[model samples]
Structure formats: structure tokens, C-alpha cells
Target: MANSPQSKKRARQLVRRTTVNKARRSRIRTYLRKVEEAIASGDKNAASAALQAAQPELMRGVTKGVMHKNTAARKMSRLSARVKAIA
Candidate 1:
């Protein structure tokens, strides 16, 4: 019920932002899933590579406001540790 023109415009902008954010979130999840699958497969080299590839994507999510910086850092830390443990 956006009666005011400004409110209507804001609602439209919100829809657009939501679409973009959803895509960014989905892309970030895909990268994280790749790392997880690589780690689960017990391939050290592949997991390391996947982790390297995912690092920037996760950071991008933080910079884009799709995820919190500390959340991304925590995930990266835990994932890297798990990757390291996969001997």
C-alpha cells in the first residue's frame, strides 16, 4: 500500500535490491558448497583450490552487504581449518 510516490519508488527499489541480493547470496552459497564438497571428498589439493577460489567470493559477499564481515571470516576460518585437517 505505497500511497506516496516516494514510497512506491522505494518499494520498487527494494524489489530490485532483493533480486540482486538473492543472486549474490545464491552465488556465495554455491562457492561455499564447492568448498564443502571438495573437503568432504577428502582431496586436499582440490579442497585447497576450492577454498582459495571461495575466499574472494565470500569476501565479496561481505563487501556487497550480502553477509556480515565476521560471519564470512568465521566461515572462512573454520573451512580453512577443516581443509588443513584433511591430510
Candidate 2:
């Protein structure tokens, strides 16, 4: 479908970017899952630690254009609240 050379190059770049983005998204989900597991275990300390670890990853997703700034902020807010509630 990409008849033009520029279009073909763009298609190739898109494929590479898609893989990278998928990896980034998966990594973020793994971090979030860790926090969820920590919270589920009812360990406030562990949940706090997990949330701390996930915060940067979530923000990094925002910076990398994998997620929106507000979306990341909202997720962080809700996760921190849940972490705080794990008493």
C-alpha cells in the first residue's frame, strides 16, 4: 500500500515505534500490578514502596508519550490514595 518511498519508510518506522510503545505499556502495567498486589496483601509498607516505585514509571510513560499527563496524574492520585488506605 505504501507506494511512495517516504510512505514506506514511515511504515517501517511505525512498526518499530509500535513495538517500543507496546513494551513501554506492558512495563507500566507490570509496575501497576505490583502495586495492586502489594495493596491486596494488606501490607501498608509494601504498598507504599510499590507505589513509590510505580510513580516514576507512570510519569515516565507520560514523558515518553505512551500516556497523557493528566491520565498519569489521575492514576497516581488514585493509587496513592489506595496505598494510604492500606492501614
> In candidate 2, which residue ranges exceed 4 Å CA deviation?
none
Task: Provide the TM-score for each candidate, comma-separated.
Answer: 0.98, 0.98
- Residue 2 Cα positional deviation in candidate 2, in Å, after optimal superposition: 0.5
How does model 2 fare in lDDT? 0.95
Let me know the TM-score candidate 2 reaches against the reference structure: 0.98
Task: Give the per-residue lDDT digits (tens) of candidate 1, residues 1-87.
Answer: 999999999999999999999999999999999999999899999999999999999999999999999999999999999999997
Highest-lDDT candidate: 1
Residue 8's lDDT within candidate 2 is 100
Query: Mind giving the per-residue lDDT tens digits that candidate 2 earns over 1-87?
Result: 999999999999999999999999999999999999998999999999999999999999999999999999999999999989876
